[model samples]
Target: MKSLILHTATRLMIGILILFSLFLFFRGHDEPGGGFIGGLVGAGAFTLYAIAFGTDLTRKVLRVDPITLIALGLASLVVSGVIPLITADPFLTGKWLFLEWGNSDIKLSTPLLFDIGVYLCVVGFIVTVIFSLEEEN
Candidate 1:
């Protein structure tokens, strides 16, 4: 059975969940939160949506295959490791780049890239599993 309240609440909450997940992802490299937690939260949001609706709608909403997310995420992970090798550093050594933007400096690091890859992989793997289980039901 369909639920009016659930549908309405899900429509509102999904965006909030995704935004919050990003917040965690950004703060992770420095603080307690990180890619793994962010991805779990993100996957939970979609899983909630799947439960309220169905797997078909969930797939449509995603707009891309979960496998694609996994592939890209793996590529990101590999690239993060390879970046240090190019500079003659040990594998997976943290590298930082500073970019000046309008009198402010932005710091980018390979660890963050690795974390992002983890985030994508977690989300993709969980969602794929959830979709499979939901479909089988």
Candidate 2:
């Protein structure tokens, strides 16, 4: 069916979009990009697919429920906040870990985790909104 072909192409494009979003996210720390923008891009992919196909089919392909994704994202953000409290630091305090190997040094931080949480939250939340809008129509 024409719809089926369109759906397939849309899904493929969505996959590409998600990959491109991740590329933007990882490259963000060094340049001028990051999770928030990446998350929006990722969500936009799914939303486009949902529009091309239908919410029911999209949900089946996604496997996980959008509501569950929202909950998980929110929980990740809350857990990240609790980490600082547990360590006796103020909430959301940036914590960093450094690793040195030969001539290379790697830096990791709680802020990164927070950004990841924000990314997930934005993706999940926006996807849910888009899906719900589709359902209403």
Question: Best by TM-score, which number?
Answer: 1
Per-model CA lDDT versus the true structure: 0.91, 0.80
Question: How well is each residue in 1-137 modelled by candidate 1, as lDDT tens digits?
Answer: 29999999999999999999999998886798999999999998999899899889989999889888898899999999999999899999999998999999788999989998999999999999998998897
How many residue pairs clash in all the candidates, one count each? 1, 0
Q: Which tens-of-lDDT digit does each residue in 1-137 have in candidate 2?
A: 14877778886798899898898877777787688888899888888778887788778876888778777777777777778887899987877889998999877877677678777878888889988877896
Candidate 2 global lDDT: 0.80
After TM-score superposition, the amount by which residue 115's alpha carbon in candidate 1 deviates from its true location, in angstroms, is: 0.7
Q: Over 4 Å off in model 2, which ranges?
A: 1-5, 100-106
lDDT of 1 at 108: 97
* Prediction 2 TM-score vs. true: 0.82
Q: What TM-score, over all chains together, does every model reach?
A: 0.94, 0.82
Q: What TM value does model 1 have?
A: 0.94
